[model samples]
Target: MSRQVTPRAAPFRQFIVKVHGRCNLACRYCYLYEGPDHTWRTRPAAAGPKVLDQTATRIAEHAARHTLTDLSLVLHGGEPLLAGAARLAAFAERVRERVPRGCVVHTTVQTNATLLDDRRLAMLARHGVTVGVSLDGGRAAHNTLRVDHAGRPSWPAAVRGARLLAERYPDAYAGILTVVDPASDPVETYESLLTLRPPALDLLLPHGNWTAPPPGLPGRGTSYGDWLCTVFDRWWSAGRRETRIRLFEECLALLLGLPAATESLGTEPFTAVVVETDGSIEQVDSLKSAYEGAARTGLDIFRHSFDQALNHPGVAARQTGIAALSAQCQACPLVAVCGGGHYAHRYRAGHGFTNPSVYCTDLQRFIRHVASRLRESAALTSGGATR
Candidate 1:
């Protein structure tokens, strides 16, 4: 599926590709594994040979033609680490070689640390795959729900794996994606993570919608907002000089009257696409909130090609016209900044992605909290430098 073949109206900034559906660790909070979309059972756990080949060709063709500025190819999955080092290495090489001249392929991976090790890090470093590990927080915070299929705690193994990966290839060790568990002590969690000094940290909102609600997070009040605000208060102060916290950055951007850069946090209808293990391309997996089959485009990447699907009416329809999705969202004061949150969270059985974010109120509250802090940060600054 190709988009009109014309120079993209805008360059493709990021593309989240599922390298494999098989994961070494089965974290309970994962959207791909735990919540919804059990389609992985029938599909190839790891990316197939033909699928990777076709993908390399298609991605290269697009990069060659389009004037892309930042074509970020994120290797995701049940856990990309499950793909193994050799195959993953070969896959990266193919992508690097095929990318059109001058168009750098920024390869990245979002993985659970259970499979990360010295060897894996070495291979990842060789392929230039910036690796980001998913860990909730310290031992207690992490073990809360990041358990295995057998209900065993994965924290110890995950910590060992992360330590090995980071220690071996510090440069390639990218960042961290931590899901905020509302029940945990935000101050402790933030401080613990700060000790790692990751290049960046992405604080994830729990995955659930108005229908079922995120675990430990209620559908009402400012529960998540409060939790995030607490973490933000600490991280903003302790985020290691230049360390980046994506969620808080977006919040400050909005507060400082700058356009929001992160689509997940704000109302920006980001250009994100996902190809399932079976090669079914669809909107981000989070849209699993919509229905059992909300995401599938009913097409395989190997057979149909990304170029073909990129132009499919179904795919194109949702990509644009996002601002018009919900009446409540449109009228909300934070509409411009939050962009009604992720497109998938816009569902409720009969209701669709048109309703406010399950955390809409929470987001607004968090935004306000950050906005207040930013004001104080600015007010305290003497000549734009915090005291």
Candidate 2:
């Protein structure tokens, strides 16, 4: 038997605040709207003042209890921009005010980018809220999947908004988040995003599970791995870190035996929590991709502390490291670097989250490729040093 791993009592360092429950655009792949979860149908269109106040209070109390010095608050959504600029500014300021002395709060908003205007940008900047936009890739073809409710393309508006942010509020422009579509040419995709000139970019795997599974994935092939490796080669050979690709950088760091910075591929305890629009405290919202209520804790910011939500079984399991993984995963050599993939990707109805990620083979292939490149680089460095 693998040695048991204990859950670390870490305080929440990131809080994802769902300021709006409905989105203007209806992206077909949205887990919240298109997935099995229907809970959003019952939630209010936007978070009210009461919910924001209680959420701020709960976060402050949690920080004090844990003695946390730094925390990040992400204004998230159906589309956080739907909450309007004034409300978002007020919410961010309220949270900042409630934080205890010496505790720093970094606020950011992740938006679909269609609603971003100069006025909204000014408001967000005034409140010190960094803006992150989601763009699938550089070209309109690359963003065909990200469309509107009327089946119209949203790329033009999104691109326009992204450009405005990059040009007007460069410092406050956090970065871009793109979901990898294996069908898109990796180099083209990378270059397309370069047009926006984001300070950083996150290449996210489409959230899927064993039961539901992500689109375009074959029954037994590493299409995603191959695609990412192509991008990796291009980025690696560039001879300079032009743009920060979160997943690639994190993988390289982990391969070099350094700490990974992201939750997607690390043994670091999961310290992020989500507050839904209705004041419900939940685990990371990604769990909604697993099934209905997969992310729920039955705790609300109004009545419960973040500490109480931390003790929920689902939340605790994610922090337990290898003990929470299946036997197959614990024995794998790449377990440490892959961290058995994201917790939500490991779900199956009968086996639960104990299984290895649905993308196990792809993860193995990608990690090995990165490790091999690192080893080759190390060998050349050592040889040059000796000579």
Candidate of highest TM-score: 2
What lDDT is obtained when candidate 1 is compared to the true structure? 0.72
Candidate 1 backbone overlaps, count: 15
Model 1 lDDT tens row, 159-235: 88777765677788788888888888888887777666677889888778877777644455788889998878777
Error of 2 at 312 (Å): 0.3
Instruction: Give the per-residue lDDT digits (tens) of candidate 2, residues 1-387.
Output: 112323466678999999998888988778889889899998888898899999999999888877789899999988888889889999888888888898999999999899988999999999999999888897898888788899999999998899999999998999999988888889999988989989889888889988888975536899888888888888889863778888999999888889775777978778899999899999987899999999989988877888888788888887787788899999998888999998888889988989988888888888899898889999999999999
Candidate lDDT scores, in order, read 0.72, 0.87
Alpha-carbon RMSD of each model: 2.9, 3.4
The best candidate by lDDT is 2
Clashing pairs in 2: none
TM-score of 2: 0.96
